[model samples]
Target: MRFVSFRSGADEARLGVLEESRIHVLHPGSTLLGLLGDDGERLHEAGAAALRDPYDVLDLDETRLLPAVPAPPTVRDFMTFERHVEGTAKLAGPDGRVPAEWYEFPTFYFTNPYAVIGPHDDVPVPPGCTLFDLELEVAAVIGREGRDVRAEDAAGHIAGFCLLNDWSARDLQLTEMQIRLGPAKGKDTSLSLGGVFVTADELAPHRSGTAYDLEMTATINGEVLGTDKWSSMHFSYEEMVAHASRGTVVRPGDVLGSGTSGGGCLAELWGREGFDAHAPLGPGDVVTIAVEGLDSMTSRIVAYSDRGR
Candidate 1:
């Protein structure tokens, strides 16, 4: 089932199951987080019930979509794709390859959950960032709480998956990384997710062991920029979860991003080509990212206009 968090009939947020061009409201006060309270089975059942009962149906055009798990408990983004890592390293200098330690375990960074936006939202270009870029990735939403989870048992902890666009300020990020402890201001600005939340059970047919055999693609202003398969990730979501849960607890609604795929961002493309050959995102550029079996998310880029800033 495809779930969507949306505002309807007076801007009240609600959970709904999307079908065709209509959404069936599952509950009046239920939210995405509330729905994921316990491994998401109840939410799945509610969605199934709504589909059968055809209750409180609303047209998709009349509802404003929100992030699948608006205000997630925590957001951990992992660098699981070797192609992305290798491509990014090449930009630093010659003979750059995946770091040796990177092979030892899944590495991730915590990002600001407050900065999340939904599909079709306008992402303001952060002030002073001329090298804005979009990262195409997939994120797994945790369904159960666990500490020190094992890789073999991590699969059951995933509630669902959604398309994620990790908006970036390349200029700021590059500078921060050089100084050794940042990626902060550069990433804190905005992150876009969800046009739809697809439950793990719904995607079982596409599963390839620990990974999904789904196509991931990104386009800007109708031009294809990145395209890859979800199967390309070197580390699986299970590995990421196990690693993240090493000495901490992971709860439901916590999001784990698969990081950027190969050629998934301008920085990688620039490394593969040249900075002069590509342009940064500016006002009015539309970025669309899609994963097979999941709804696509489209965000429009706008210039920052806070006169006070």
Candidate 2:
């Protein structure tokens, strides 16, 4: 079942489950994390029970959709895609290797949940980002809170999945990494996360392999920029979960991102060749990222102006 957080007219954000294009509103206190904490059977039952006529809840177009999990306890984005890692490394230098530390410990970063925008929202072009890039990723929401979980048993803790666009300011990222301070300013700028919020059971079939057959595509200004498959990742979500649960407690509502996939963005796919010196993204360019069986998110890149704020 698909879940969402949304607001309509003057109402506050509320949780709901999707039932054949209709929405069945959950209780006021019910949240994505709460449902995750429920066992698979219980979750299924709850979703089934909530099924009702779509119009009975609210009109989809009239509602203001928010991030599926608006306030996750913590957000960890992992660099588990091998193609992205290798290609990104090559861009930095010819000698870069998948860092040993990345394998031993899943490399991740804390992102701003407040920066997350819903589908169709205006994704403001940050102050001076001439090289804005898109990273197609899958975000996993934690269902069970745990500490030091074993890698083999990590699958049970996942609550659901959501499509994520790890929007990047390439120029900022390169500058930040140069200081060796990690992806502070480079990554902290903005993070677009939305599309369908599907449950773990829906994606169980593709859980085992380092990669899956899921197709990914990115379009800028109605032009296809990147296309690839999820099977390009070097590591699986289970390993990242296991690594995250080590030493610290992971709570329900925590989000884990599958780093950029190979060919996920122009920067990684075409390197310096993709950039158009004369025509950078202006105020009206639209970007759409879609993954088959998952969902598609479209955002309009608007210039940042003081009056708009």
Candidate 3:
């Protein structure tokens, strides 16, 4: 079942289940993660019972949908994709030999929760940004809070998954790298996340690394810019969760981002100069990233020229 956090009229954001083309409000006491954290049998029964008809509950188009978990206590974005790591290494480091620690553990970064925007929202291009890029990724929401969890038991902590676009500012990223403080300015400023939240059950069948063909495509102003397959990742979500919870507790609403795919963005496919010289995206541009089973996230670039003086 699809779960969402939304606000209608003057009401505050709350949890709801998507049914047909409408939304059925989940009781105030019930939470998406809490339900999933319960025992498997109990959780399944509750979810099935909640999936009853939602015709007269609420209009899907009329309400405003917010980020699935607006106030996630912590957001961890992992670079588990080998292609992304090697490509980024070539761009940021020497010899393309990603730090040995990167391979030994799941590397991640924290993002600003306040900067998150929902589906169809406008993404403002930070001032002086000529090279804004989009990274298509899959994010998992932590359900059961745990510390030092074993890799084998990590899957149980996942509540659900959602599509994420970790927007990037290429120039700022380069500038910040010199300090070695982390990707604060390059990443935090331009990130736009959302689309829809799909329950873990819906993604269970695709977990086996079998023939699950999840495809991703990014389009700009109705033009297809890039495409990639999800199966290309070198690491799985369980491995990321295990690494992340090594010495700390992961709580409900925590988000884990699967790094970009092979052709996830132009920066990785082509060098920075090539991207700047060939595929420069400016103001008034709209970017839409879509994953096969997951939903599509669309954002309109608010260029410097477009902003009010």
Candidate 4:
């Protein structure tokens, strides 16, 4: 089943299941965060009954779709793609090489949850940022609470999946990370979600052992960024969930980003194809991404209000 959070006119945020171009609205004022788990499997019934029989149906074009899990409890982005890591190393300079530690476990960084926005919303180009970028990736929304979960059992804790766009200020990120560590302001600018949450059973047919055989693509103003397979990830979503739960707790509404695909971001391309080959994102540039059944997401880059003369 596919679900989304939406709103029309002055009505409050509500849950809805997507069927083609129409949305089957669930209970009024029901947010996605409240229905993120299944019966016994986790908790919350996962809104199965309501999803099976919605309160009303409406044309999707008439209402505004919101982030699948608006205001997630917490968001953690993990580096699970080997090729992306290798490419990032190349961008570091001539002595670049993949770190051995990356092979041992999935590495991740916490990002801001308050900064997340809907798919159709505008992405602001942070003030003073010249190297604006977007990451085409997938994120797993945790369905239930778990601490120190095993990789083999992590799948049960995941409710569903959605596309994630980790918009970035590359120049700021690179400079700061070089001195201190991980990104903060560089990535807190904005984040985009697919807005449609796809249940695990719906995608089970496409499962390929450790990964899903889903084909993902991204485009910048109609130019393709190269299609990649979701199955190529060196670390699976379950593994990332397990690693994230090693010491702390991962609760429902928490999001787990699968990191950027090999060529999902401008940085990866600049690293693999040479820095001069492609340019950074700017105002008016539209970015879009799609992953099989997860529905597509598009965002237009808008200039910061304080910038320019």
Candidate 5:
């Protein structure tokens, strides 16, 4: 089942199950993560009950949606797409090359969960950011707690998936990387996630060998930027989760980003093409991403300014 978190009128953020263009509101003040924290069977029953006798129903377009997990406990973005890594290397300069270790295991970095924002929310362009860019990918939310999980058993711990846009400030990121670290300031400005969460069962039809074979695409200001299939990831979500669990606890509401798919971000495009070939994101640009079953997400670019400015 698909679920969404939204706020309407004077009410606080609330969870709801999506039924077509309408939302069957769940508890009056519950959160999406709170529901995910519950037992799977109980959550299903609650959703079913909500659908049958919704205390409130609202048109999907009428509410302001929040991120799928709203405030995830933690966020880890993995570099699982080999092609994207290779392509981005060219943009990294002459000595740029994909590290051999990347092929050995799925590598990831923790990102600020507080920076998370929903699809329809405006992404603020950080001050001094000139080469603002967007990374289009998929994100999974952890449902059950686990540690030292095996790849074969990791799938059960995932709650759902959603589209993720990892916004970046290329120049800042590049400068930091030159010192052998960081994608931090460049990335922490915002992390856009689709408000709608598609359960694993709902996307089972798109499952391929290890990853889903869903078609993912992104556009800027109505112009198509890139498109790729989720099946291209070298490491599966299961593998990534298993790797993440090595000597560490994976908790419910923690989000796992699939990293940028091949051709999914302008940085990769710049490497494949040339730096001068494309323009960076600027104020007023709208970035929209869509996956086969997960609903689309659109975010407008805005600048940090005074309240009345």
Candidate 6:
């Protein structure tokens, strides 16, 4: 079953499972975060029960979506796609190939959890950003708490999966990372999560090794940017989880992102083609990302008069 965290006409946050035309409300005051604890037993029970016997129902058109895991404890986005890494390596690598050390482990960077936005929300263009871009990816929401986890054991800790958009200020990212310190200011601005939260079991049939057979697609203003299969990723979500949990804890509500796919962004296209194929985004540009069997996410780029919003 798919779930969504939404705000009704009254402006209060509510959790519900998506039915055909309406949202079956969970128990009052229950949240996706709270339900994810205890190895997802709460989530499993809550989702199943809500679907089986809903206590309340809301019209789908009367709700505004919020990030499925509204405020993740931490967002660890991994560069799991080799082709994406290879494309980036054209600049970050000595040759055109990735460094040998890259094979040692799954590499990920911490992104801001507070900046996360719901799918279909407006995305503000960071001040002075010229090369605005969107990264098409999927994120696994960690449900259980565990330290020193093994790759094979990572599944039990995964609560569910959600489509994720890692918005990028390419100019800022390019300049900041030159000092070997950041992708911080460039990345901290916004992260878009799909409105629907798909449970792990839903996608289990498509599992292929550490990867899934899901296809990822991204478009800007209704035009296709590119598409790549999840199977193209070099590292699996489980491997990333194990690497992240080496000595620390993978807590409930933490998000792990499968970084940008090959040709996922215009930056890679420019790198591959040696020319600017698409101009940077501006206000009113609609960016959308879709992953097979999961919800499709959309964000409209906007120029804000008030940054506080």
Model number with the top lDDT: 1
Instruction: Give the C-alpha lDDT of model 4.
Output: 0.84
Please give the RMSD to the true structure for each candidate, in Å.
1.9, 2.6, 3.1, 2.4, 1.6, 1.8
lDDT of 1: 0.87
Model 5, 7-126: lDDT tens per residue? 998888888899999999987766667766533555677778889999799999899988888889899999988888998999967567999989999999999898898888888887
Alpha-carbon lDDT, every model: 0.87, 0.74, 0.72, 0.84, 0.86, 0.85
Show the colliding residue pairs in model 1: none
lDDT string for model 4 (167-234, tens) is 99998998889877879889987889878998777788899966799888989998998678898999
Query: For candidate 6, lDDT tens digit of each residue in 173-287?
Result: 9899989998888997889988888888888899986678888898999999889998888888889899999989999999999899876887777666553567888888998
TM-score, per-candidate, Cα-based: 0.96, 0.89, 0.87, 0.94, 0.96, 0.95
Off by over 4 Å in 1: 306-309
Residue 56 of model 6: what lDDT? 84
Cand. 3 TM to true fold: 0.87
Displacement of residue 163 (Cα, Å) in model 5 is: 1.2
Better of 3 and 6 by lDDT: 6
What stretches of model 4 exceed 4 Å from their correct place?
37-48, 306-309
Sorted by lDDT (best first), the order is: 1, 5, 6, 4, 2, 3
Return the lDDT, model 4, position 50.
Answer: 58
Using alpha carbons, what is the TM-score of model 4?
A: 0.94
Model 2 lDDT per residue over 171-255, tens place: 8878888887767655665677784688878865865466467888888888886687876667777778888888888888889
Candidate 4: residue pairs that collide: 37-46
